[model samples]
Target: MAQPTTSILCTDLGFEWPDGRPVLSGFHLAVGPGRTGLVGLNGAGKSTLLRLIAGELTPASGAVRIAGELAYLPQDLTVASDQRVDETLGIRAKREALHAIESGDVDERHFAALGDDWDVEERARATLDRLGLTGLHLDRTTGELSGGQAVLLHLAALLLRRPDVLLLDEPTNNLDAQARARLYDAVAAFPGVLLLVSHDRELLERVDQIADLRDGEVTWYGGNFSAYRAALAAEQESAERLVRNAEADVKRQKRDLVEATQRLAKSAAYGKARSVRRNDPKALADKLQGKGEETAGRLRGMHTERLNEAKERLAVAEEAVRDDAEIRIDLPRTAVPAGRSVLQLERVRLAYGGVVDLELRGPERVALIGRNGSGKTTLLRTVAGELAPAEGMITTPVPMRYLPQRLDVLDDEATVFRNVKAYAPAATDNDVRARLARFLFRGARADQQAGTLSGGERFRATLAALLLADPPPQLLLLDEPTNNLDLASVRQLTQALAGYRGTLVVASHDYPFLREIGITRWLEWDGGELHAVDPR
Candidate 1:
């Protein structure tokens, strides 16, 4: 039974390029009224499929139909460099109002809807505040917002639209845990069809169902991403077992055929001996001849059929396996020597725009975990020597490097190789160039402008440069290093950090990632006095 006021459906869906090459082929999906996480590798056309479903782009083949308005939130939600947060929110409100007026029943001389005329301006301001975009001048142009703020503003606008479907690509990316939690709450409460693409394991684990795009089509599993992963692992194991069995069957058949052929040969010899002397072997000779011929035929027929079966079985078994595009990362390292003091903070205090008491410190990788407005960034700034600890004594080594939550240290105009040379001036082009390759920025990509790189690529580029530094910064500070990174890159970084002999301080929400890097020391900030606790 199908219950549907409005549901999306696709059958034998497909799309291809102008050259008759397929981007998606024979795709099929049935999206009900729930959140579905789109899981696939980088180039799996997940975003393209979302666009097709939203009617933002038409499929070249087959059908993509939705009955109501849809909202699309792309991964790269950067506004034009000059758009102000308030102005953008206003535009969104006005658009929604116009859409409502156009579609509402009162368009042709009918009474207007009973609701009050929505305040686009006030509501726009309210929307920004709700998304932590308060205090920014509405009239200020878009160019002024920080990269993270810009992303947040776009998200606020998208949410205000209240469309019937949401196609979000990496919505939680680059946001801290609090922001991510807020995003999750919004998605959970949203009463519409949602299809989003993300590599965040935690984010995907909460979706209603998972839609896996593999081999040119979508496969729907009626559970969260974790369940789907478990099922996939089981399937992979089963496929391997089937392959082994099929191989063994072929070997057994070969042995049986050899035995049969030897029996036939022996029977032929007996027949010849009986026939040659004509020594009272009359019926025996005739019987042996007839039996040998029959046996030979049977053996030939059985061997042929068995061989064919084995080949077919092997093919079927092989097709069940998936390609090995597993995520991988390798962090470049120039090690740091251990010292008695990695970092020191005393009776620290912090506040946003005058708020203050967020003391922090660590001689090792220290984690700062708390809700938003809890001063995580404030604490990081204080440690980075960027902010003056208003009420406490903070001491840090003069030569430590800070990788801010946002990559503010790198120049967007410079290529990765150049960036490294600037940070590590003593290094040669060849040395820096080779270092970039280990981080996946090879050759011309190493020469690509930083401004043109993706969020993940930028993270890699910044970290690569840090590694090339002359002293490699005996102390390291990372703010959400895993955010926006694909799983492979994360693994690479994890492996690199596992062996590094440096002091680390991190402000992140990823508990697992924190645990992996060996956070031997931790400080929890509660209304601003650092409480020491063993993170082990």
Candidate 2:
């Protein structure tokens, strides 16, 4: 099939935060029909660029040209508490006008309001059903829906508009497996200029191409996420080889410069000695020595210039090599013995009325998987002793810690340092700083208020506090750990988990991440029952 024409263009785009932090400057982008996944590290301005294109925020300088109507779904979606389904879908006005005309009003204004959209209600309901919101009443309020449902409702609204250009920013951040599958279908069926900014790997894999936004620039990679990753890995390997070759050249140049200097010194000394042996006059001898010195100096300058040029080349080559840091820490104290029972739940009925019976021994990594509102979070909280089971007994033999999905463990008013200090009162300031550095909060960042940090930064701070808490939690319970995290942050979380030697019970919808941490068992919660399952 022939490719669709370009519908969105950005030329010489420039934007900065109110505090003068530069985001995009002299940036340019052109997006045609088909899906394009926008990916980058946290705080790389992907969301800001999308907002600029959506006209939610004006660019400091530049032009955004669009050929057709556009729709945008932001990362954080909010609807009025009393907003009706039809109103959210933007068809309430037409529906109301149609109803008024059907009642024998026969007003030309009603016809004008209806325009050519006589079946607007039918289309709206069809769009909602397609997005897994089946049986939802048009007059139903948004306050009655779950977070995942609300996100789907927002997508349904955009689909109902039939926009020629659609921009989705982290659309699947709060979606469950079923909801995500529905979204994937919607995206696959879209016939428009689609630009998606998301960290969901599965969603990215479905895109026609990947647009990587980095360092205030955009670079397009052909094909999906896997292809993009393959291309990036090849580029990094080549860059690393170039750096090595450049380093070798710099070393060789430095060695040659040293050898040349020694040769010049020997030649100068030999020339002076010959002049002395000739019994030359003192003034003539001095003049000869001065000429020899000047010649040596010029020769040295040539070699020095070559060495400096080689160093500059090396610097450029090094710059091309990416410095993607990984989280590395050793927590031997958090390790559990091989035969020790870490946790036991005896027919435990949670506050949500879900029954779980399980015992974890040693340092097993357990993956908890379920749909939204399936009691996964409730189970984790109960296991962490944050909530008492409604019935039966629960026992944890070691220190336990829970990292909730909202990441509210830290006090917003306190600095990251103080928060961690509060958790580990016996730990010294230097020790706390050292641990925080492992979580990528180094120096002044450790002193920043928890409330002031970005989402990814705040997550790292909370993780640092949990891992560095007093007694060192041996049983770690993480609830939806990868939600709202950027790709780099997700990788960092995986790397941190790799270094953890304690028992882990992580409730998440991220399969790739669970596999990365070497989950030993998979448990699925369905209809208030927890049962083991094969993750594959």
The C-alpha TM-scores of every prediction are 0.64, 0.86
Q: Write the per-residue lDDT of candidate 2 for residues 404-427, one digit (tens) a residue.
A: 877888898898899999999998
Candidate 1 local lDDT, 1-536, one digit each (tens): 95455567777777764444356777888787888998765446776677677676667778877757777777656567766555576563453454566687455322233145445557667767776667766667876454456666777777777777778887775566566766776777778888878877777877899988877777778788789989888999999999898888878877777887788788778778867877646687678678778878987788878877887898899888765332233433434444456566655555343333332233367777655445666667777779776666667653578888668688987777888889888878888877777777777778877765656677778887775577766678787787656565577677656645567777776778889888877766654556676644
- Candidate 2 TM-score, true structure as reference: 0.86
lDDT of 2 at 61: 97
Candidate 2 has an lDDT of 0.87
Best by lDDT: 2
lDDT at position 87, candidate 2: 86
lDDT of 1: 0.70
Which 10-residue window in model 2 sums to the lowest lDDT?
A: 449-458
**lDDT score, residue 50, model 1?**
73
Candidate 1's TM-score reads: 0.64
